[model samples]
Target: MTNEASRPAVDLYSDTVSRPSAAMRQAMAEAEVGNEQAMEDPTVNLLCERVAALLGTEAAMFLPSGTMCNEIAYRVWVDRGEEIILEESAHALHFEAGGPAALAGAMVRTLKGRCGIFDAAELETVIRAPRGHHGQRQKLV
Candidate 1:
């Protein structure tokens, strides 16, 4: 069996393998950098506008990472004490390490499926029927 030291040096846990190309580096060096939270940066505003236009939406905000995006979405869509229905192998279930419960105050109900994909019928099976304040409500999928 191969040991840990025998494995390749490349890291597979995160998306840090790719390096910025020379053109990208030059563009970043020349591009105007600004405070994104205050919406004062021209580059950020342009990107948001471009994305909104492309998606036919009124506005869009650029997030730093996918984890941030997921957390924000869960906070916005799921309410406190509510639950999210997802597959057993979902990234949020395994990777986030209880962020949904801690940050959003939401719980997860996982369904058995293949490759994190489940059917509507399978979802309906696990849904908690509205029993007036007895159990956590399933809110977002």
Candidate 2:
């Protein structure tokens, strides 16, 4: 027997559904603006530096979406014919909606795991040099 009404559904949907508050809009309007591509945008630069420092990364670049960020990272890490190893159910794989393949021109080796966490053993299996039996092995993001 199926209790359709009693089923608990989780909204694993896009974050763009969130609307900015009035205060946030006002803040944006008041925010000082500059060219983003040149890293001359003060706000964007500050945010990137702040996030990079928090995450302990060498540097960071601000972009419009996580899809863009992930795709850009993949492109930067690997050449046109390389590949990325990630969890089978990672946001980059499922949620980005093919941004990796479209943007980076890279193959994905999706390892199995629960939720989004992959074990070291599973990762070890996938992280191999792409060769005669394999493909292009380049980067992981």
Candidate 3:
């Protein structure tokens, strides 16, 4: 008993649908897990250290999800009531449930781009000089 509609032509919807290899599952089962907040997680600490070394950074912090990373980046780069330019098809804009606005108090200005990447001309069009106190400050892209 099978239904053709039960499966999709291309299943790129989410990371959730993927299954781990046997070795990966074994590694997870044997992993030394601890509290990330207290920096007691040896695995996380090692991963961060290695990533930092590879990226030529002094230190690195780990975030579990892309959504959290985006929020953290928004907080770090843009202040409240500021603006961030994103492509119309960006995950933070659509999938994150207005995280740019709600989490960081950011004003989002989306530019329609080819394959989610906008060019300089498109960018130049949206960017405005500080209009007035009433106008939003243009921040990160």
Candidate 4:
């Protein structure tokens, strides 16, 4: 067996494994940082505006990570006791560690799909119809 020290340093664990490149480091150094939550940061406001324009939305808020983005979206769009449909191996379900249930009071219904992708027909099969108090309302996918 190879020694641990001799193993390649490439980490395949997550998207955040890489350090910022020189250009990114330079940009960060030059950035005009401010309190973003106060809505007074000029650089953040500009980035939000640009992203909003690109996505054709009214506005956007730059979040620190995808997990925060998912949590926020779940809080906004999902009601308590509602269900979100997803593949069994979805990051929201597995990686986020039941954040939907803890944060949004939401539940998940998973589909059997290859590589976290499910077809529309498969989605249709699992969707809970809007009926009186039988199952949780299907909110987001």
Best by TM-score: 3
User: What local lDDT does model 4 show for residue 66?
Assistant: 81
- Please say which candidate is ahead in TM-score: 2 or 4: 4
For model 1, give the 10-residue run with minimal summed lDDT.
10-19
Candidate 2: RMSD to truth = 5.2
If both were scored by lDDT, which would come out higher, candidate 3 or candidate 4?
A: 3
Residue 24's C-alpha lDDT in candidate 3?
A: 95
Q: What is the Cα-based TM-score of model 1?
A: 0.78
Give the range where candidate 4 is weakest over 10 consecutive residues by summed lDDT: 6-15
Candidate 2: regions farther than 4 A off? 1-14, 17-19, 38-40, 52-59, 128-134
For model 4 the TM-score comes to 0.81
lDDT of 2 by residue, 1-141 (tens): 978786446433345756678999999999988999988899898888999999999898777876777777887888766788777778888877788788888888788888778778888877765586355765774
List pairs with backbone clashes in candidate 2.
none
State the C-alpha lDDT per candidate.
Answer: 0.85, 0.78, 0.89, 0.87
Assess candidate 1 and give its lDDT.
0.85
Clash counts per candidate, in order, are: 0, 0, 0, 0
Candidate 3 residues 16-102, lDDT tens each? 766778999999999999998999999999999999999999999998887898899999999999999998888788899999999
lDDT of 1 by residue, 1-141 (tens): 869797667744345655778999999899997888898899999999999999999999999876778899999999999989889988788888788998889988999888678898888789867768877888898
Which tens-of-lDDT digit does each residue in 20-126 have in candidate 4? 88999999899998899999888999999999999999998899888888899999999999988889888888888789999889988998887677899888888
CA error at residue 8 for candidate 4, angstroms: 20
Write the candidate numbers in order of decreasing TM-score: 3, 4, 1, 2
